[model samples]
Target chain A: MKQRLVSPVRMVWLLGALLIVCILASFTLGHYPVPLGQLLGILGSRLGLPIEVSWTPQMETAVWNIRLPRVLMSVLVGACLAGAGASYQGIFQNPMASPDILGASAGAGFGAALSILIGLSSVGIMVAAFAASLATVALVFTVSRHAKGDRVLGLVLSGIMVSSLFQSATSFIKLVADPNNKLPQITYWLMGSLSGAKWSEIGFILPPMLAGLIPLLLMRWQLNVVTMGDDEARAMGVNAPRIRLWTVLCSTLVTAAAVSVSGMIGWVGLVIPHMTRRLLGADYRCLMPGSMLGGGIFLLVVDNVSRNATTAGIPIGILTAFIGAPFFLWLITGKGDHYEH
Target chain B: MSIEVSHLSFSYGQRQVLHDISFQVRQGEFLSILGPNGVGKSTLFRCVLGLLSGYTGQVLIHGTDARSFSVREAAKHIAYIPQSSRPIFNYSVSNIVLMGRSGSLSTFQTPSKADEERCAWALEKVGIPHLARRCYHRLSGGEQQLVLIARALVQDAPILMLDEPTANLDFGNQLLVLEQAKSLTRDGYTVIQTTHHPEQSYLFSDRILALQNGRILTQGAPSQVLTEQTMAQLYGAAVTVVSLYQDKVRVCVPKHITIQEEAK
Candidate 1:
């Protein structure tokens, strides 16, 4: 039989299949190792399939209340991070730029850390976290507006400096918290897990994610122009300065929200966009959605391993660092294809 | 649209570059700025393009002060192709040209079918249509300059400005760029350019504006401004100017013109 390579249509089907596998696999990878049948039964029950099951509270609590929300949160946060990263790298015209490195992430991390230092509880923490994230994004924007026109280098450099400052202060603040009571909690949160994600956290993130992604999708072609450089972009009739302003504002907002809740999910925001570029090419029309799916699924898998990779219950970031390091090294030293034309 | 600069005096940090330089570009004339290096050709062009702020003068493009125009609005009226620039990254040739469309577009809008057609036409007009899909940075220097000119052409602005547009290009590419500039001027688009080659000013320009040490030395026809005396004063060297076929001026510099020899 002659071999037929898959078309883009088939490839899209493959992406959908992979998404299903990831979701199912995520539900089964936790500590208790919920059986495939029981996992499906719980999911089906929630979806109104009326499957009968043992009413053991452990099954209901672990599957419905705990693992389900955590997994969903992982997908949502990962998608947001990856999308934000793609937009950011596009605007900066640099392949290595990520949401965290440019100060947006650090700023959000600092705001949340400061809120924790002020002794807010779980209910208050969510409010403080989202508010602080938005506030940090606003600070980056306000500082970057040096002239009447949009200033790209100005925004990026300031972002870097501000982030470093916040990071040092966060370390100092973390040091002074009560070691026995609050220190361990702060440490765990910094590991960046989906364990804290709730319905309300989802609610807060959804609005900005949708708001941010809509403009990006609409202006996808302009992002193509921006990649050419600002002067060239202006000649194309893009109001290059204002486009820069709007894009930075939206990307910063999404990144701030992602960093606020998860602490700092590293690599997904940077590497996923590059991966999408390699996979789908630099055309932002497809690359934007590709990064969204790729980022979420990558994190979903990492989170699965974090919950049950070892008996020690490893912190998510440690596991992510371990998984991401070898690939990053391979990306740097291997075929030299990351910025392919 | 006419470009009018009147009583324009500009300086850079106490070092004056242009003093009371006044000129008017008729609605579709090809105007050339002719001067040796260190003259105010580029400074004058930048001031007219509104790239610099706080210069005392009046630069009116299409009957409005340059300061009154937004960057995009100015781009719509006056398109610029710099002498050369290094983007240092990979972007498609078509994408590079598409930037000329942004000044007329909104943030939420995209390059339309009409815009893409214009990009194609501009690239084809400059004779580099095949490079549209290739990486911009990998093109040769001549090809890069052509690509930038194509971008400006696509802007479809009424007034086009080029600064040293032929400085680094090879002989053939220089002809190519200059001829394209000439065609734009012929099409009723006011073309303003700066050149070090005095002969080039006569060959390609309808009006020559010569500068020496931050002031207009002379502004008129080639025969009126370019002389053996003017070349000697600008370079401090002995030279000769000759009129060639088709009213083109030919410039020749002696290999061994010394002050001692001249004094003797």
Candidate 2:
């Protein structure tokens, strides 16, 4: 067992294979079950693989246009949340920090809520949600920019303030919303399902996700320095303040995009980074990518459970909350108590 | 190697902390700063290190303005050992010392084999090579302080800045670390350290600087700066300074009344 303790490197490769298996399983076994070979044939047909390409047009549409995009969206959003979470944790020097506390996810939720309450179109609603999340993070960044020392503390306080302001604004919109039509739409969106995903939404999400994740991958080493304290970081020749500002901007944007599309997928961000930290140690070079992969696989499993729950379509967020709440309590009370007050 | 500070004055907003603090140390000299509490010793060092800017007058290192240097560039020439015990984690002793090398390395490079060797050499020099593998927090307060010094040693800069390097040490570690710092000056490394122990400063330092009220009261050889009149003026107490062994060493005993109270 001791010898089997996989380094983050080996574990990442292992998780990659497991994710592939789960992805294949989830795609094959959804409602109106496509056979594994037929699903493979359809996927192979799309990629120009030489085969008879067995499924009908409607089956092909369901598998390729619907299931595939939804799964891909889950993977993308999951990886983004976990990566953003780890980045936030490193920036704040607090293990409990995640994008939710930093106003990215809640900001998006409030934005979408406002749009639904105001009777906007689908694309307009998505844009509203994305913009609101971005705006909230920007507000937090601006307010906390001048705080002397403890930039993370400045961020959390400002984020909570912004979240509350937007949340109240959303409540006001809901109070005035058309209860007959708008309210149900708002609540349904808030429940958060990949059923709403499409190729265009995926298009909007991928750029910000890639834009943020790539830089985080490259600069993971620098994040390690800043976590040790900015003065200590500057003493070591790193321009800690500049690095922090850039990272906060990138991470905020990615988390905002994820939340805009996925409706505040809880626990992936909080749990993934903590799990990565425990499994991988504190080295960001390993932890950053490890969190990303682990988050993708974890979300895939949860999404699979949501699809297969007994005659009830479970909200993936609720599943995460169920798993996350206990794990969070354990984190606070268990071995990770060093992070808490 | 030569450090020259000309008429340096600093303040936090309206309240001045260091005023007209002028002093110089020739290349490869070991100097100790001694003063009563709240005498701006740390403030003076911070000015020289350029951590606190907007101070009047110029601090010139090798005839260049200290203010002109970036934090990294300044750190490249000077290694600062701030007072320790601020860390909450159990970073290893060797790892802590190896952090001294960070300023010199590029952004992407991890600590190299040579850096590890320097860390080893520094730990060995401080006579705690065995403790190199131990967790920093698990060590005694004295050992922890020495580990901090070992970090400074590995920095390999020409000038070492220490803030009360022995404040928490046991008597033996105090003498040990000070002797090690004194020996550094022999190899052409300049040392500027603050100390409450005037006797040890007199024993190990080439010069002593006395500061009070955000200004330098006196700075010269130990004989000139550690005089009875200067001690009385700086500390604002009636102090008796005694010399022995052909005036090679001076000791500052409490003003007899304080000593009496200690006996009681």
Query: What tier of docking accuracy does candidate 2 attain?
Result: acceptable
lDDT (tens digit, per residue) of candidate 2 on A201-235: 99988898899888888777677767767766665
Which residue pairs show backbone clashes in model 2?
none
All models, DockQ values? 0.31, 0.30
What is candidate 1's DockQ? 0.31
Q: What TM-score does model 1 achieve against the real structure?
A: 0.85
Q: How would you encode candidate 2's per-residue C-alpha lDDT over B36-138 as one tens digit per residue?
A: 9887888888788777788999899877888888877877777777666455333457767777777777665567789999999999988899987666666
Output the number of the DockQ-best candidate.
1
Clashes of 1: 12
Tell the DockQ for candidate 2: 0.30
lDDT score at residue B167, model 1, on the 0-100 scale? 93
Mind giving the per-residue lDDT tens digits that candidate 1 earns over B97-177? Answer: 877776667767767889899999999988899988776766777888888888888887888888899899888888888
The per-residue C-alpha lDDT of model 2 at residue B180 equals 82
Model 1 per-residue lDDT tens digits across residues A1-341: 11224432344456557767898887667666677888888778889997998546688778777777778778877888888888888788777778765576676666666777788876565556667666665666677776334467777777777777778987987999888867777677667766656777777777877787778768776787777677656544455566667877777667766766677778888777777665655666567777788888888888877777677667666766777777777776865433323
Instruction: Give the true-structure RMSD of model 2.
Output: 4.0
